[model samples]
Target: MNELFTRIVSGVIYAAAIILALWSGKLATNILFIIFGLICLFELQNLLNFKNYVSYFVFPIALIFFNYFNVNDEITFLFIIACLFVKLLLLRDLFSLKGRNAFRQKKHLITLMYIVPSMVFLTLIPKLYPDYNTYILLYVFILMWINDSFAFLIGKHFGKQKLFAKISPKKTVEGFLAGFTFTIIGGILISYFNQTLSFYNWVVVGILVSVFGNLGDLVQSKFKRKALVKDSGKIMPGHGGVFDRMDSIIFSSTFVFGFLFVINHVS
Candidate 1:
């Protein structure tokens, strides 16, 4: 009961902070992410046991360049492509037997290419449409939170068949489906209220969030398993670390940004 209370309090505070930042406007959101990105890097650095000091610089630089400045669409597209490629590679590594070994070899590259850009793209999501609407980003986080909450609750009570016992023993197939189903529902509801995206697009976003968000959590679990650590950090009382909390969003942001971009520009 005490542990559950701690989780609820900490989760509420964390969500409040993010909502405040989003409502505060672009600079606040960017600053919040920079701090978050740095903390995530620090946590991952400990996990990977890499001593490269330069890894810290990659995130702020890339984030400021890609976001603060008005870079051409061509350049932005190329950068997004690079980040997507590395993200897919990370996804592929998750399924391989030698995943840890592969991650160990490319720790610095992963930091630069994967971890940094993912967070950067998250900030860009709200700006995908004309004018910077915080509601879009807020809704994204809400969907993720819903998915996560349902996954945990349903997994703990009704879970039977393990989704991946090796990496995350607690996760189950039932939980995953529950999270996905509810996320689509969340997307529909948000679409009616927000009008940022049509019902169909929001549903697509919900599917992306549910699928990739779970994969993100699994990937982070894989990282922790490789590091032999139970949690990323003790920053949040109940929630492991900033990385632990943001893992799903961080991993899924790029894909969400890409989809938004295509809808905004191509469609």
Candidate 2:
């Protein structure tokens, strides 16, 4: 009971912070995410056993460069490509018995590639339209929250078959399906209310976010397994750490931004 109360309190506080940051506009959002990205990097550094602290310095610089410099679309495209490639490799490593051993030698590069660019793309999401629209980014997060919430609630009460027993023993197939279903519904409702995107596009976005978000959770779980730690850190009492909270968004951001970017250009 106390655990549940703690989770609820921390979760509300975290959500409030994000909402306020988003509502405040560009600079506030960037500052909030930069702080989040740094915390995530710190947790990931511990998970990956990073001894060097260069990433602590490199993260904000890279984020600021990509975010504020008004770099051309070509550069952004290349950066997205690089993030996708590295993420795909991480996905492959997630399922492999060897795990992330292959990339252990390039720890710093992997750290920079994995965390920094994803956050950059996430911020770019709001700017995908002609103007900076916070609604789109907020909706993306809304769908993620919906998916995650249903996954947990449904999983806890009715979960039977394990989704990834080796990596995340608690996750069930039933939970994933529930999350996916509700996310699509949430997308449709958001479309009705916000009209940021067409119904079809929002549906597609829901699918992408749900599928990738869950995968992100799994990926983080694999990292925790490798690190032999239960939670990423003690930052959030019941929720673990900032990385623990942001893993789904971190993993899904690139794909969501890419999809929106392509559609925005094509449309």
Off by over 4 Å in 1: 97-100
Q: Which candidate comes out best when scored by TM-score?
A: 1
Global fold similarity of model 2 (TM-score): 0.96
Question: Whole-model Cα lDDT per candidate?
Answer: 0.88, 0.89
In model 2, what are the clashing residue pairs, if there are any? none
Candidate 1 local lDDT, residue 247: 92
Give Cα distance to truth, residue 83, candidate 1, Å.
Answer: 1.4
18-74, model 2: which lDDT tens digit per residue?
899889988888899889998898899899888657777877887788767888888
Q: Estimated TM-score per prediction?
A: 0.97, 0.96
lDDT of 2: 0.89
